[model samples]
Target: MSIPVGDVTGVEFDRNTAFLRHTFLGLFFLLLSLVLTVGIVAAVYLGQVETRTDIAFAGFFGLFAVGGWNVTYGLLSRSNREVIDVYITTEERTHVLCGELADAEFVDACAELVDSDLPTTNRNPKLEAELE
Candidate 1:
């Protein structure tokens, strides 16, 4: 969607949300790996008989570490569509840098209105009733 170019005084944008799904998943995997490693080491130190379960868990931890590393990289390089480009101009010409959409021109006839600055007039009910 194309938004009319307006004279903006401020600009703020981000490439990613605070709670990125991949990032959280990566953290979960990495933490799960460390927990498994620690448990295996403690078991070995306590002279517990080595079981197939421990071996399986060690392999799972290794897989988690590898998967988590890849996920972290993917999350870092992901593009954010929610990012917005802000443009401000004091003259007839304006410049924009909205990824693919750039250099939007507007005729001088259309005056940009600031909705926030619109005046709100209070209506008197008695005055309206008398007129009716």
Candidate 2:
């Protein structure tokens, strides 16, 4: 018979992953903007171009503004997010599932089912050998 195993819920997993991804993207854009700005300044100082300086400056400022916004938004939203991992167990094996933590009934059901089946025996030979 199939039965719900349990649910694991927290913001840490999703939050950290999202935070890192956003942070990396934001930093990358910021670095790109800095490089472009420096390049434009150097070119203008060397008198290499006269008409394109305005366009370059606009692009540089746009990147800086957008990147800064993204970094701030990502950091702020990180703590407010959450993720849930659910598991179901059967006589043969355990299966992983996912859902929102707001489903309290589901979480309770799964936790109870798993708790009732506590101290499960390891049937896999590899795992058994490892235990030995």
Candidate 3:
């Protein structure tokens, strides 16, 4: 649906939740890998188990390295922010607005604005009939 330009409302920028979640996951993986590598090294040094071949050590080290890289890149390059465009649906079309704001605040504001602008209506009978 298209909205008229005059019907457009405020725009807000919100935090990119996906980016934050992924970043957290990356850090968790990095820490987990480091602990595993350390535990393996400690086990070998303490004679808790028989010394394995170099391949085992290499594999553990590889996992740790990859995790570290992922966390580093995520922190250095990615910002946890995204643009959210808000629009009002008018008789003619929908008008879109975009700007930067806190994610929670933007959502609350958008919900309030949309609720005020639009009326609650019943479901479409044609669509409901198709479902059956």
The root-mean-square deviation over C-alpha atoms between each candidate and the true structure, in angstroms, is 14.7, 9.7, 10.2
lDDT, candidate 1, equals 0.41
Of 1 and 2, which scores higher on lDDT? 2
Residue-by-residue lDDT tens digits, candidate 3, 50-90: 54665576566767766676665676467665444444445
- In the predicted model 3, the residue pairs found to clash are 2-93, 2-94, 3-93, 3-94, 3-95, 13-100, 13-101
Candidate 1 lDDT by residue in tens digits, 2-112: 334444333222122333345566566556656755665676688673778866776676576566556656665565332223233324553443321111232111112
Off by over 4 Å in 3: 5-16, 21-27, 37-57, 72-77, 82-99, 102-116, 119-132
Candidates in descending TM-score order: 2, 3, 1
Error of 1 at 52 (Å): 3.4
Among the numbered candidates, top lDDT falls to 3
Candidate lDDT scores, in order, read 0.41, 0.47, 0.51
lDDT of 2 by residue, 1-132 (tens): 344334422111111122223555656666665666677567667876656767676566667756766665665455433234443444655566554444566446434434453443332333222222
